[model samples]
Target: MGKSSTSVLVILAFFAIYVIWGSTYLLNKVAVQELEPFMLASCRFTTAGILIFILAKIMGIPLSITKKQLWNTIIAGILFLSFGNGVVVWALKYVDSGFAALEISAQPLIILLLMRVLQGKKIQPMSVIGVILGIVGIYLLVSQKQIIAKEESITGMVMIFFCMLSWAYGSLFVAKADLPNNYFVNTGYQMFTAGITLALMSLAFGETWSAPLSWSGGVQLSMVLLIVFGSILAFTSFNYLLKAVSPEKVATSTYVNPIVALLLGWYFLDEQITAQSIIAATILLTGVYFINTKKTLAIFERFKR
Candidate 1:
């Protein structure tokens, strides 16, 4: 591919990561209305995993890995998919998709704190302020009268908080862990491992699969979208972006996704976007931008002065 072609494809990949991923939150809400959370997640991942595995094989990518690496990938999958995604799926029963996305937007903040605590990394003062602002944003979001009107909403918000923490830890671990060099192969294993674990959880929890048989066309379509667009396409695009762009650039998805989700939720699901939500989203995304680009932002400020 020529340089211009490559650049266009990179932009498309970024679009997939930002828009498709944001849309998944609302799709999950639609899917879980009829399907059990664990079972729904299991089916989505298993299908996507198998499809990606086949694609990897077709591309002649090696699937071999050490037992230790396999274990590490499995653990990472549990953290990311089972706890991170599965909990959010369950919480969708009580929370709006937009609210869930907003809550998840705080992942960078949590990851920074986790790194500081676990890796003993020192945080700059601006990053510290960013984290504090993120916390305040979350507080403003969940403290709204609409959110606190229901007990289950509070539970859902709390669940999303834990989901962010799990996802952050999984991301940090996977960054340093031994895994397949091929992104498709590595993600295949991770999704497969997570699928199997969620399947077991579905069985243990006595979740019925027959519910999906009675689902509406909209719900069924949402599941297909979640599997194909949300999981497969978006994930592959993300992996591609990690190779093509700087990590900070890829991290902008965290800022863009919540806005996309909020708009979609309001348009399709008629989910309310209150003043508090807008304010919280502004605060949260601004903090995220600062956290991700603190040095650049500081330099820009210097130039302005």
Candidate 2:
């Protein structure tokens, strides 16, 4: 019974990260239509972070951390949430959610290259092939004339590329950083600080803010789901699955999320799934698989959408 129950929980956790995290792309797309991008991220992270902390306290988990840890969490928060997520939300104003998800699916490739450059890690032969395929896939996707013709689309693509860089570097940082020992506490601090940073970024950009009550029903629902499901439930499940399953199994989300986002965007928003995009997604995801086949970048897996 004990083993069966544990297996059930593990399966459910995988569902949460796969479906819920995948759906966040659509949720952010919906919310960004009505809210300032940074502000949308701010509200989601702030509310979720606070709830995590409150839950931690209720469960008698320690919240204390060293000064160095606090500072590291702040940096991680800014990299992973304030810029990585917030900037991607901003890009959704000009880019299709599914398209953005596809491009970001190159994240593991980016992390692998970064490891080569920053850490002097040798690319395993398989990862080297993954890198070549990933590059070709990205070129095929981004070189679409229709997408590049729009100036704003081009700009959104560029910014999202930078956001991927931030996320990749954050993963490398977190792997070695002195963070809170408990994953939940580390995430709480990161989210809370990133929330505050995003709010400031919103204000600095002179973006207008509105009360939740005044938001459109769809946007409001999107925000609620993003906060409670995308930010909280799915994230907690990710942590749980990291303990309960192999890192390679948990890493499957990296490939699955973009596919989910693509399907949802097509079904709900009538977003076109171009033939070229299909080719690109297939190639890109194949590359991600080869990269993760034998190697584990568990920290990199943990941080992305």
True-structure RMSD, every candidate: 4.3, 3.7
TM-score of 2: 0.89
In the range 1-305, model 1's lDDT, one tens digit per residue, is 69999889898998998889999988998888888999999988888899988888899887889999899879978987888899899999999999899888887777777767986766667778788998999899889997899999999988988988888787667656677777777778888899999999999999988655688999889988988898888877765665555333465677789999999999999999999899999998888656766584454234223
Q: What is the total number of backbone clashes in candidate 2?
A: 0
lDDT of 1 at 96: 91
Going through the candidates in order, what is the number of backbone clashes in each?
0, 0
Candidate 1 TM-score to native: 0.89
The 10 consecutive residues of candidate 2 with the worst lDDT sum are 296-305
Q: What does candidate 1 score in Cα RMSD to the true structure?
A: 4.3
| lDDT (tens digit, per residue) of candidate 2 on 54-122 | 999999999999999999989988988899999999999999999999888887777778877987767
Task: Give each model a TM-score.
Answer: 0.89, 0.89
At residue 15, give the lDDT of candidate 1.
91
Which run of 10 residues does model 1 get worst, by summed lDDT?
Answer: 296-305
Q: List the residue pairs that clash in candidate 2.
A: none
Q: To one decimal, what is the Cα RMSD in angstroms of model 2 from the true structure? A: 3.7
